[model samples]
Target: MSGTLHLAQALSNRRRRGRKKDFRDAERLVKRLVSQELTLSFVPDGEHRLWRTLTRTRYQRTRDKVRLQNQLEALLEEAHINLSSLVSDLLGASARRRCMR
Candidate 1:
């Protein structure tokens, strides 16, 4: 799919008009790949793919952790519980016991 638009444009007979979006998308992909901003492969590379998957998973988990921390902080605020002000880790043993009660 890389450089698909450029190839399509270059190969087009010009006997018919094609969708603008298609050409635009292809152009974007080509530019990104050419600029090395985007990485792609037509053949499967197991180790590379796995590394990519692992990084993506780690990123998603980090985002989830941040979201949960924000929600927890908001809930504590709503309940007038200022655990964060007292402890560095609000979900740690000390804060958890207070929250449970």
Candidate 2:
């Protein structure tokens, strides 16, 4: 027997119930979960969640590194240092060596 189940809200034809929603409505939702009434939907397993977390973190770090490099380049240009003009890479070895001077 499959012990795991994932579900989502099944779109309903019920009339719109607006700002009057309260704790009782939440209780109903819990009851649905208990009774396996929610519509089936994609739910990633533990391994997939871990993989997503790792990849997302790596992607975000890469973006942050690139952003910081761009900011540094802009700040250097604003200070009238045209290191990027002389070097193919602003943060490369040659530029950094020149900067150390």
Candidate 3:
């Protein structure tokens, strides 16, 4: 038995359409995968599941911050603001002073 877990999406066939066909396809696929020595993973333990959730949340927040920064820079550019050229971060003191004026 293979201990390594392999994750893959189910095959979508346009010709096959019912739940029975899907069940059959899934059964066949599992048999073929087992023959090839691949195993699907089960749910992780509590700690690992919590870690995954936290990491995913952090990643999403980072992405949102980056997206917001990009939008701010784009808006400033549209308004003919060049604070980015003067300061590395447009959210810093120099840019804030410029914006205040």
**The candidate that achieves the highest lDDT relative to the unseen native structure:** 2
Which residue pairs does candidate 2 place in steric collision? Answer: none
Instruction: List, residue by residue over 4-75, the lDDT tens digit for candidate 2.
Output: 665664673132477646686667766777787766578898999999999999999999989998998899
Q: Per-prediction TM-score, please?
A: 0.54, 0.65, 0.57
lDDT of 2 at 55: 100
> Which wins on lDDT, candidate 1 or candidate 2?
2
Model 3, TM vs. native: 0.57
What is the C-alpha lDDT profile of model 1 across 1-101, one tens digit per residue? 46342323333223235666777766766666577655343544689889989999999999999899989999989999788998788768988877678
Regions more than 4 Å wrong, model 1: 1-44
Which portions of model 3 miss their true places by more than 4 Å? 1-40
How many pairs in model 3 have backbone atoms within 3 A of each other, for residues 3 or more apart or on separate chains, i.e. clashes? 0
User: Can you give the lDDT of residue 22 in candidate 1?
Assistant: 71
